[model samples]
Every structure is written in C-alpha cells, then in structure tokens.
Target: MVPTLNAIRHSRRHLARWMRPQRRPVAWTFRPARAWIRYQPLGCIGIIAPWNYPLYLALAPLVDALAAGNRALIKPSEYTPRLAELLARVIGRAFAAEEVAVVTGGPDVAAAFASLPFDHLLFTGSTAIGRRVMAAAAANLTPVTLELGGKSPVIVGPDYGVRSAARSIAFGKFFNAGQTCVAPDYVLAPTHMVRPLAVALLREAQRAYPTVADNPDYTAMITERHHARLVAAIEAARAAGAEVLAHEDAGAAGLRKIGPTIVLAPPAGSLLMQEEIFGPVLPILPYDTIEAAIATVNAGDRPLALYCLTHDAALREAVLARTLSGGVTLNGTLLHVTQDGLPFGGVGPSGIGAYHGRAGFERFSHARGIFQPGRFNGLELVRPPYGFVARRIARLLIGR
Candidate 1:
C-alpha cells in the first residue's frame, strides 16, 4: 500500500511533463516543416493483478492509466477478495463508475475480464497465467503488457565479501517470505565460498526473525497449497543429495509457514532448480569462475531480475554485458524496482513491456506523430507535372 501511494505521488509530480508533446527531427528535404509526437490516452485500460502485493500491483498500473488520462477497470485476484472489495468501495466513492472501477471474482471472471476489448491490458502474475491472459486479449487484438515471473539469479563476484552479499540476499528473499517476484531466486558464488555464503544467509535470516512460527514480522505463505509446494521442493532437493539448512521449525501444523531454508548445490533436475522458488528458500550453486557463472545464468530462460554483488568495475560490466534480465540492483537486491525513474518490466519470457512513472504514462498513452508544413515547401520542385526544373530536382534528390 505504501509503495502504491508512492507511485501515485510520483505520477502526480510528473503528470504535466509527461503529457507535453515531444519535438521530433524533420528531414532536410522537408525544410520549414516541423514534427512532434502528441501523447494521448488509450481510452480504457484493463489491469489483472496478482495475489502477492495485490494492492500495489493492481493500483500502480492504474496510476499510470489515470495519469495518461484513461479510464481503468481492475480485476483483483480472488485470493485477496477482502482487499479487493475495500478497493472497490474506496474507488467508487472517489470517482465516477465510468472513470475507475474494480471487479472481484475467481478465474472465470478474470478470464471474462481479459476478453474485454480494452484499449490496453496489463497482467501481473506467473508466466503460465500471463500466456493465458495474452491469448484471451488476442481475441480483441488488444495490446498487452505482461509482468511475469521467472528464476531471478544473484551472482556474488569473487571481489565482493560473501557476508555482505548474504545480508542483502537474505533481506530480499525473506522480506515477503520470498513471495516477491524480483527476489533473488538462487545464488551463484565461488565454489569455496558456497558454504560460507549459506551460513551467512542463515545467520542473517535468524537475526531478522528469531522465531518464524509466531513472529509477527515473518510472513507466512499465502495459501496451504503454496506452503506444501515449497516443502515438497525442499525435500526434493534434499533427496537429490543437496545439503539442506533450515531455520527452526514452524512448531505446529496449519500455520502455513515454512522456516527460512538454504539448499546447497541442488541438482539441475531438482524442483528447486527447475522452478521459481517464490518462498524463503535460497539455493547456492558453486561456480569455479565468473565465466562459468555467466554461462549458467545464460543457460536458463531470461530472468525477471539479476543481482551482481561486486564493486569491481570490470567484473560488473562483464556480467552486465553477458546477461539479460528485467532489471538489476548492483551490490544489493530489490532496490531497482523502487526507483520511480527506472523502467520496470522483463524481457523475453519474464515480461513483455515496462512501466513506472514516465514509462507507465507512455505505455498507456499513444505517441501520435504530427507534422506542420510551411507554405513554401521545397518538395514542390519535384511535383507530378514534370518540367526541366522538376526533372532536375528529382534527379538531384534521387542522386542522378
């Protein structure tokens, strides 16, 4: 909610600048003619938000749509119905129904919402669901912006301190119990530092939440099924010969909480390695050299975010050059997305387009090109009624 409010404030602060027309260059042949791009609203935008950070994901895009001068219809995830209802009530009181509205329901309703002939659609969720939303939107030939999730990786360069990297990783991974889409999904560290990094991560996690089961600061999985899935993945990694380190147990059943865990060198085929571990489970993989680490990251689908813990300029530049992700936070984690100036979205499978502040405004607005020609146009010399002058001008323009 705080982040969403911040986004709203950002939009308000920059709305005027974003709405102004941008000047474009005119060709030499079109002297005295001016060109510019007019930013116009897309009319209506459809937002399909996810369960995690429901309020922020749903309203942040709406902030952009509104700043772009477009009406919006939001469909909040079924998992967060109460908040959805609250949002509907608040928006209803604040704006006319035609201006802004919220719809709440299950997958069926979400599907129907996606099929609407909106001017543009933005969906934030898992890649599987993003695919379905895009297909539904295709029926209307509506443009879409997909903010999907993937296995975001962290690379701890040899030049950086393992302990420092571990602290940042632990904070990001356990912030929402690792429910965040941009959380560090796994770590690639020097082979010798793998165990040290894992130990440091556990120490940091313990310091943050001494008691995971009953601590108010520590969050639980959103659903029982999600908790079970995480547990199964941890067990699968352990069964596959990976060394597992876990914080104290949750102490009872049905708490829907799994203690923070670290899996060391999980096999390539293990569940922890195969899927995005959107939980408080950190996997540390060993890489002998930076080249090998880059190779490993490139082997997977392009991640949504990438973290490189290094102060060495060359090493950072090499990693930046070799890898592709939606965004990056150097020597830290999850801070890149908070920057209102930076565009946030993934490339390839991670996401389709970017949005935040001005980027968001531009995403929801159309760049209509406009031109004004002077009364004395130079192109008149090459008119259709060919004469000596016209032929000469045409030959000169066309290079003889």
Candidate 2:
C-alpha cells in the first residue's frame, strides 16, 4: 500500500509539471479575418472510487482534477475504511481540505454525494451499481464518467502455443483472485483443443501459484456475500450440466480458498456463460470457428476487454475489425491497463467513459471554443433594411 501511494505521489508531481503550463494551447493564432472567442475553466469535480485498487483509483482522478485546476470531492468506498482514511491523510498533506475532501458512509452517503451539483463525477464499480449512480447524477443533470465492468472474454486459437497461451490466461483470470472486472470470464478455444488447453491451464496455474492452499499472495473475496455468490455461481453452472473440470471439494471452511478451477462444456444459456464469473473458476467452451466466437460476443454488451491468442496477423486483424470491445489484447490479457499513457475505461454495458492518458484530461475538462474576429473590413456592405446590395452580401456571408 505504501509503495502504491508513493507511486501515485510521484505521478502527481510528474503530471503537475506537464499540466502547469497548459492553460490553453499555444498554437492558437489570430487571423485577420476570423471571429474571436476564449477558453473557460470548469469549477469543481467529484469522484467515487471502488474498493479494489482504492488508493490508485482515488488518486488517479484527484491527479487529473488538481492538474485541470478544479477542486475535487472524493467519496471512497465504505467497504475499505482504512484505505479511505489513509487517502484523506495523504491528500491532506498534499492539498487543502477543500481542494480535495473525503466523505464516508453507506449507500445513502453515496446518494447524497451524487446528488450534489458537481461539475463532473467519475465513478468506478459494477455495472449494476453504476446504474444507480447514474440515476442519482441525473437528479442534478450532472455529467458523469462511469468505469463499469462486465464479462470480458478470451479466445484461444489453435494456431498459438497452447501451453504459453494457457499460462498467460491463467495469470490474468486469477489475478486478484479474479476480482478484476476485466479478467477473462470464460474461454473460447477450438473444440478439438479444449481438453489440451484445459490441461495446460491447470498445469500453469500450479506453476504460477504453487500451494494455493497456503499462498499469501492470493487475495480473498472482498466479503462473505461475494464468496457465497462465487460458490453459488459455480454450483448453478454444475447443476445445469456443466462439468466442473477442476478444483473438486478444495474450497471449504473460511479459508476462502478456491484453487483456480475450470468448468467444461457449459450449456449456452448457463449462468457461467451469461454472467461475469469474477472468480478462479474458468469456463472453457469449444468453438468451430473464430467467426462464431465473434458472433457470440457481438450478441451481448460490448465487453470491457477482449483477448485472443493467435499467430496469424490476418486472423488477428479480421477479429479486431469485426468486433467491438472496450480494449483488445492480442495473445495476452490485462496488460493494456498497465499502459499509463493509454486510456483505460469501456463502452456500452462495459462502461461509457474513458480515463487515462489524454482521455483522462478530456473527461475532467470542458473544452470551450474560442473564435476571434479579424480587423479586415470585408463585412461593411449594407448595415440596414432590404436591398439588392444587402441580399448579395447575405448570399456571400451566409451562403444562402
């Protein structure tokens, strides 16, 4: 946590240096024949952060808000109070109370926070909760930026190395114990390759986290409710005829240990296929063609992220051209969010706004247009009623 906070502090200074001199673009040049206008500053902003990656998420928007010269109010997730208080202290050290304030509490607090007439609000969380936040913001007609998560998918092509592909995919799906919104919910591999890929994935999972029964690096589900939900989700998939291909009877007691399992051949309408399985339980489905995989995804909400493992450039290009996801990763997963210079949000049910790089700046800013009138006297034709001269001037000026 300390290390993460230190990184945030470093980034804040770096961004401040870059943004300090950018009040308006220096490229604006006055023409002798144009109209004049000026840019304006937005007042203040509000941000609601999620429990996962609390410090980083909170500080990310704070960095943009301060750099954009707008005061901000932050409502950190009540689920993690310690981190929220820690943020308040750190930010207080760096800014005035009013410049960045921290508010705490339950859904009611969140509602009140969202109802305030903020110039802009940025929220990060589940899509269901995001809808409520959006509805609250609508009360004030406040502009909002939502970073919601959905069922991200992975496609494993036969052309790639199965072992290597499975290795990378395992790390991504189980990272943070699959709490990540962008984690691959299910896998679409070739029908003939499913068993081979599944075997390789289990092998890689063991390689990545040997002794998951006692590993400290593994993150527990945030709450008992989530843990039960994950368990129930897996059960529902199993009852519906999906074979639980891995982790049999390992996760019991309060250990909160779910050793990277996979469900095989789940029916098309099973819960495992319909929702984001944000756990270590990976589901593998067989696909005859990549086109069929694309069609399946296109039928649903635009995913937050889509991943594919293939060696052929043509196949990769074809898939990218035909499908829409918040982000696409070729032959890998979850690396796109690490690109600090790239935008990191989604589209459609996955999300609506983007932030990171230039998108972050634009999300917190309102770009006002400026036009300057020239000194040339080309418009003094007929300043009055209706005449032939006025009509001609109108035709030339208005292009009527």
Candidate 3:
C-alpha cells in the first residue's frame, strides 16, 4: 500500500516534465540546424506482471504507458485471482477497452499474451520466464523490458559493527517474507564477525517479532509449494553440516509461516546457497578479506542489488568499484529502489532495461530525433557528385 501510493505520487510529480522535448545543441558542422529529441508514444504496450506485489507491479507500468500517451494491455498473474479480478473490474470502469484492459490467466494465456505484437512489452518474473517472453517478443521485433529476480548479496564491511548491520539486513531479508526480488539472499561477513553477525541477526528477528510463531506481523511464504521448497532447502543445508538458528517456533505443517532462520557457513553446494531462498532464510559466509567477499559475489550471476553496511569512505568506494550489481545501498538496504529520481532495474541475468522516474516514460516512449535542415547548409554543397565544392566539403567533413 505504501509503495503503491509512493509510485503514484512520483509518476504524477514528474510525468509532465519527462514528456517535454529535449532540444539538443547541434554539432559544429550542423550549425543553424534545428535539432531536438521528442518523446513520442509507441501506441500500445503490454505489461505482464508478477504475483509478488501483484497490484503495484501491474499498475506501475500501466501508469507509465498511459502517461506516455500509449494504450496498455495488462496481464495480471493468476495466482492472485481475487486481486486480479478486482483490477480488471476497476480498470474496465476507468478506461475504454482499447485504452486499458486487464487479462487474468495462467501460463498458457501468458504465453499467448507475450507473443502479441504490441509496440512494447514489459515482463516481471523469473529469469527463465523472462527468456521465453523475450523470445516471443523477438518474432515480432517488439522491444522489451524485463524485470527478473536473482540472488542479491549483502557484504558487511569490517569496520561496521555487527548489530546495526544485522538488524537492517534482517528487516530487508524478512520483509514480504523474503519473496521480494531485491531481498538479500545471503551475507558475506567478515571472518571475525560471522558468528557475531549471525547472533545479532537472530536477536534482531526476535526483537522484531517477539512471538513469530503466531505473530501477525510475520508474513507467510507465498504458497504451500513455496513453503515446502524453503523447508526442504533448509533441511538439505542442515544435512550438509550448516548450523541453523530459528528466532522463534517453526510453525506446524500446513501453516505457511516460517520463522526467521539464520544459517552460518552453509556449504556452497547446498540448496540454500545454490538457489534464491525466497523465504525468511539468510545464509552468512565468512570472508577473510574484502577482496574475497567481492570476488565471491562477482563470480556468480550479477545480483539485482548489492549492500554494504559501513561508514568508512574507503571501504565503501572499494566495494562500489570492485563489485557489480544493478543497484547498491550503503549502510542500509532496499531503500535505493524507493528513490523516485533513480532508475530502478537489474543488470545481466538479474534483468534488462530500467524504469522508474523519467526512465519509465522514456522506456515506453521512443525518442524521435528531429532534424530540420538549415537554409545555407553544407548538405547541398556535399550532395553533388564529382564537383570541387562537394569533393572539398567531403574531404573536410570526412577527414580523408
């Protein structure tokens, strides 16, 4: 609810400015020419939203398409049936069928929607699904913006003490029951601070949810299958010699809730370390040096976001330079994506293309470069073939 409202306020505040033409200075050779890049609508856009943050993700892109003067067709996830139906109802009332419409469906319908030849397509989901969507879009030569999830990592700087960092990591990791794409999947802790950080993480979880077993504040995993996957992963990690610390009771079978679980030195081959634990489980890896931590992260697929908790300028700069992620949050977590001015998206396997603020408008709108030739131009001088003036101008312009 909070993020949805914030996105609306942000889009309204800046949409007009982003629509204005950006007049550019012509090159020295093209003096007296009028040049500008105009933001033009791409007609119709298709938005395939994910189940997590179902309402916000579906609406956020739709708002951008409308703001850019483009009609939109939204395909809301079938997982959230009730919300999807409500969205379809509300959108149908607010917009003409051609201008904005919602389609609720499962995988087959999604695949059909993805193959549509819209002016542009935006997909938010897993990397595998994003690939299929892109492939379908490619047949029509349609442009696409993919927002996918991956295992984001948090590296704790040596100078920063364990307690504050642990609390922030726990909050970000456990928020939305860790189903969030940007949630920290694991932590790279300093060698001497690994145990202390684990302890602090458990302490913070306990402090936040005193009775997590029955606490209303603690969120349940998105579904029964997701719950089973997390539990099985945890059990696998335990079998692989990883120590697990539960801040509160692990609820009985059939309950979706899983207490905040802290893992210490889980084997790299274990399921918990191998996959994106989109549950309230965080694995901490001890590193003797900052280089080791950075290397460990860079070796894997580029993450959606990277976090470091530290006040040291040198340490911050070092991490910022050596590591690669779509976004970075220093001394905090998950707050970077909330900034309205910055572009929000992932890089490499995490995602392709960006949105939010002016970026969202530009992503949906094509920047048509307009060039009106000047009265006394060199273009005419260089147009004729084999003439002295044309030859001279060609030589001068082409530097041959």
Candidate 4:
C-alpha cells in the first residue's frame, strides 16, 4: 500500500506536468515550422496483476492509466479473490464503467481477458506466465508491459562491513517472507566475508523477529505447498554440502511458517542457487574479486533490481555501470521502487518496459506528434514535385 498510495499521489500531482506538450527542435531548412509531442491516453488498458501485494500492484498501474485519461479493466489474481472482491466494490463505488472496473476470475478467465484487444496491456507476475500473457496479447497486437520477477542479488563490497549490508539484505529478504519481486534473491560476498555475512544476516533476522514460530510479525508463505517446496530446496542444498543456519525453532510445525535462515555458499547447481527462493531463505556466495562478483551477476538473466552496498563511490559506480537491471538500490534494498521519480521495471528475461512517475503516465499514453505549419514554411519546396531546388533541399536535409 505504501508504493501504491505514493504512486497515486505522485500521478495526481504530476499528470498535468507530464501532459504538457514537449517542443521539438526544428532543422534550419524547416524554420518556422513547429513540432511537439502531445500526450494522449491510449483508449483502454488491460492490467493483469499478481497475488503478492495484490492491492498495490493492481491499482498502482490503474492509477497511472486513469491519470492519463484512459479507462482500465483490471484482472486481479485468483489467489486473492476476497481482496479482489473488496477492490471491485471499493473502486465501483468511486468509478463508473466508463472509467475503471475489475474482472475477478481464475486462470481461464484471465486468459480470456488477456486476449481482449486493449490498446495496451500491463502484466505483473512470474516469468513463466508472463510469456503466456505476452503471447496472448500478441494475437491482438496489444502492446504489453510485463513486471516479472527474477533472482535479484545483493553484493557485499570488499571495502564495506558485512554487518551493515547484511542488515539491509536481511530486512528485504525476509519482508513478506521474501515474496517481493525485488527482494534480494541471494548475496554475493567477498570470499573471506561469506561466513561473517551469514552470521550477520541471521543476527539481523533475529533482531527483527526473535520468536519465529507463529509470530504475527512474521508473514506466512502463500501456501502449504510453497512451504514444503522451500523445505525440499533447503534439504537438497544441505545434502549438497551447503550449511543451512536457522534460529532456535519453537518446533510445532514448519507448515506455513518457516524460520528465517541463510545458506552458506550453496553449490552453483543446487536449487537453492538456481531458482528465486521467494521464501525466508537467503543464500550467500563468496567471490575472490570484484570482477568475479560482477561476472556472477551477469552470468544469469538481468535481474529486476541489484543491491550494491559500499562506501566507495568508485566501486558503486563501477558496479552500476557493469551490471544491467530494471533498477538499483545502493546501500539499501527494495526502496528504489518506492521513489516516484525513478522508472521501475526489468530488462531482457527479467521483464519488459518500465513505469512510475512520468514513465507510467507515458507508458499508458501515446505521444502523438503534432506539426504546425507557418505562413512562410519552406517545406513545400521539397514536396512531391521534385525539381532542382527540391532535389537540392532534399540533399541538404538528408545531410548529403
């Protein structure tokens, strides 16, 4: 709700500023002719939102779409039907069909909704289903913006103390039990500091939630199946010579509530390292050099967000330059997306396109180019009838 409300207020405050036509510079040969980009809403938008942070994800985009003067049809995740129903009712009370509406359904209904010929479609979910949504939208040539999740990494710089970086990463990784899309998937630490970073991460988690068993402060995994999956992955990593660290368990059941833990140097091929944990488990990988750490991140698909915690400005700038991601949060985690000024989204396999602030307004809009002719405009000299003057002007315009 924090990000969502922030987006709403940001859009309301900035919509007019973004809507102002942008003047474009004209060529010397075309003097007196004016051109500007006029922002207009892309008639109807179809938004497919995900389960995690359901309210924020669905309405954040909706706010931008409406602020840009476009109506929207939102399809909330089936996993959160009750919340979806509440959203529909609340929004219905405020908006008419011509402005905004919600469509609640399961997978098939979502598929049908995605196939509709909306001017634009924005999807926020996992990478696997993101492909399917893009394919379905492709059938209608609907432009899409997908906010998919990837294995975002937190790098502990050689010059920085593990205590500070580990503290930030722990808060991010365990928030909502690591279900956040931009949560730190794993940590890349200096070889000598791997053990220290692990211990520091556990310390931070303990400080945050001392009683992990049924502690309301600790969020539960989405499902029993998800909990079981985390258990299996941890077991697999343990079997593959990875040390798993967890706090003293108030042992009743590991079903929905798994204690915060960290994995020390899980094998490169293990499930703990391969997939986005999206649970209360953090994995730390040690590297000998900065180049190797950057290489480790570049080896996989570009992540949605990269966390670099270092006091050295040169090292921070170098890391940002070498790596590609949807966004970056220096010396912190998950806070970048909350900033209304910066655009947010992923690159390559991480996701597609971006939105937020003016970016969001523009994403759901078409910047229609408007060209106005002046009384003395000389463009006619280079129009259809090609003569010596026309040919000469054309050549000049083409930089020949």
Best-fitting candidate, scored by lDDT: 1
Identify the superior model by TM-score, candidate 1 or candidate 2: 1
Tens-place lDDT digits, model 4, residues 1-400: 7778888888888777898999998877767889999999999999999998899899888888888889999999999999999999998999997789999999999999999999999999999999999999999999999999889998888988888887899889999989999999999998999998888889999899888776788887888888888889988889988999986566514647888879898889988878878888889998998899999999998999999989989889889999999999999999998888999899988899998888889999999998887889787877776789999888878889
Position 224, candidate 2: lDDT: 84
Runs in model 2 lying further than 4 Å from the true structure: 1-31, 34-41, 248-252, 377-383, 396-400
In model 2, how large is the Cα lDDT of residue 5? Answer: 52
lDDT of 1 at 287: 96
lDDT tens per residue, model 2, 27-98: 223224443222234678899999877877887777666656688999999999998888788778987887
User: For model 3, where is the 10-residue window of minimal lDDT?
Assistant: 246-255
lDDT of 1: 0.93
Steric clash pairs (candidate 4)? none
Among residues 3 or more apart in sequence or in different chains, the pairs in candidate 3 whose N, CA or C atoms overlap within 3 Å are none
For candidate 4, the lDDT comes to 0.89
Give the lDDT of residue 222 in candidate 1.
Answer: 92
Tens digit of per-residue lDDT, candidate 3, span 311-340: 889888989998888888888899988776
Enumerate residue pairs that collide in model 1.
Answer: none
- Lowest-scoring 10 consecutive residues by lDDT in candidate 2? 22-31
For residue 60, model 4's alpha carbon misses the true position, in angstroms, by: 0.8
Model 1 lDDT-worst window of ten: 248-257
Candidate 4 ranges beyond 4 A from true positions: 251-255, 383-388, 391-400
**Measured by TM-score, how close is model 3 to the native structure?**
0.96
